[model samples]
Target: MDMSETSQPTIDEVDLLLANARLRDELEPYRDESIDTSTGRMNLRTENEYLASMLAWERAPALPIASWFTPVLELPPPDSLDDDSLNELLSATIEKLYSQKVVLRFTDHLSNRELYKIIYRDILPCCEKKVEIPGKFLEWRCFEDTDTWLRYYADAVERRRYQEEHDVRMPPSERPKYRRDLPH
Candidate 1:
């Protein structure tokens, strides 16, 4: 075999070389003991792959959530959508968001319209770091309150512990107004 034939790198190898160089360049400023002084546990290829993934996450762009979708997610005004239509759209939208690794939490307290409105006006339009790291999901909280968790998720013992810890009277626990089977 000709020496050139054996020496030439394939297209995939070239791409990997370029990507590794780019990752090294991007990580240069942040170079520290964490990566450079890492214990000799991971082999060179595995270490480089892990470093490349961390660099990719660090360099991800922050853009409107809707722009993350292929065709771009757009929903009509919540008021115009009837209850049935809103519910249908909400379910589909939740699935779409989940497909993009976005999860909604504590949504049972909001009505269908309220939840939809938040997804439409707040989450869909909000700018967030679009990290493509696997096993990483962005959690969107529909309502902001510790009391909500205490009321809805906490067991009787947990609630009593919270009351004792905070020395505050616990509100009577009631079922959330609307039930949504959202992704965790």
Candidate 2:
């Protein structure tokens, strides 16, 4: 192979550049994060991925969090009718939120009814901001006050684990990393 072939990126550079360009094409799209992908080209695939993620987050739509829980969403809030009603509502809620690129975390403490109430009263207020772009989402922090939620709500196993890990016996935040990607 010629020195240029090894020293410079091949046509694969065009593919990476094109993929980056596609990011912006979704909604009048515009973006680029190129990986040389050529052998001995100082692998930039990881960096490119990170840069692409950062760019998406920077350009994503900013919407109030409450909009996510509105009745207008794909799944409506659960009715407080019967025993199974709350669970059904929660199942639907998780699915709808996931589809909309929302994730909830650190919520082992609250019962189904309580969790729903917070979504209705607190999350539905739509005051908090969330960044949502294609392949990205806005993470809304849930009830994660260590002094309160963790102290009172955490189960014995969770509390013991937390104590063992931190020694401070308190969570860094009542909720941690609310906006998380689905487990890959």
Candidate 3:
């Protein structure tokens, strides 16, 4: 009913309008660029670089959990019978890597370890029977210590090199020469 009360409402309205404008400006980059959202895909390399930069920002950490796990889990399983069995066993081992107590405490719920155990003991063995490779010899080398694991990891690098040499054909003695005198 007074002059101050009327002016207060006007000030509040201006404040709300300013806040809404700020929010809209903040969200401008995420707005739809195309009419068909389903067809729109982000550039993976650019996104990855952007994410790396963001993770390297002062307030954040670069914990690439997905990248670390992808190579190990996404590789094709072995073809031999024993290797096939080992693959099944490895799958089960991965599933049960975190114990029940750890899962319950961390996830705040119970998980079915029985399925994992069954896969390890039963399903894996059946899968192994179909493979042509010697299962017992492979199984003997399956369990290893941290040093052994590192050695195996290094061995994989050699395997990769061998695969690249065998599969990729390159012309001999055609290496490019570097010119170092031009740039400052």
**lDDT of every model, 2 decimals:** 0.84, 0.57, 0.33
lDDT tens string, model 1, 23-142? 778888877666562526875466568877777666899999999998999999999988999999999999999999999988888888888999998999999989988788999977
Supply the TM-score for candidate 3: 0.20
Best of the two (1, 3) by TM-score:
1
lDDT of model number 1: 0.84
Model 1 sits at a Cα RMSD from the real structure of 6.8
Tens-digit per-residue lDDT, 14-123, candidate 2: 77767655543442434334432223433455445655665555565556554655655433454644548776776676667666666765455566776677666666
Best candidate (score: lDDT): 1
TM-score of each: 0.69, 0.52, 0.20
Enumerate residue pairs that collide in model 2: 24-29, 24-30, 25-29, 66-126, 144-174, 144-175, 145-174
Give the range where candidate 2 is weakest over 10 consecutive residues by summed lDDT.
175-184
Mind giving the per-residue lDDT tens digits that candidate 3 earns over 108-129?
Answer: 0112233333333433343121
TM-score of 2: 0.52
Q: Any runs in candidate 3 off by more than 4 Å, and if so which?
A: 4-10, 33-110, 114-184
Off by over 4 Å in 1: 1-26, 30-53, 156-161
Candidate 2, residue 106: Cα displacement in angstroms equals 1.7
Query: What lDDT would candidate 2 get against the real structure?
Result: 0.57
Q: Is candidate 2 or candidate 3 better by TM-score?
A: 2
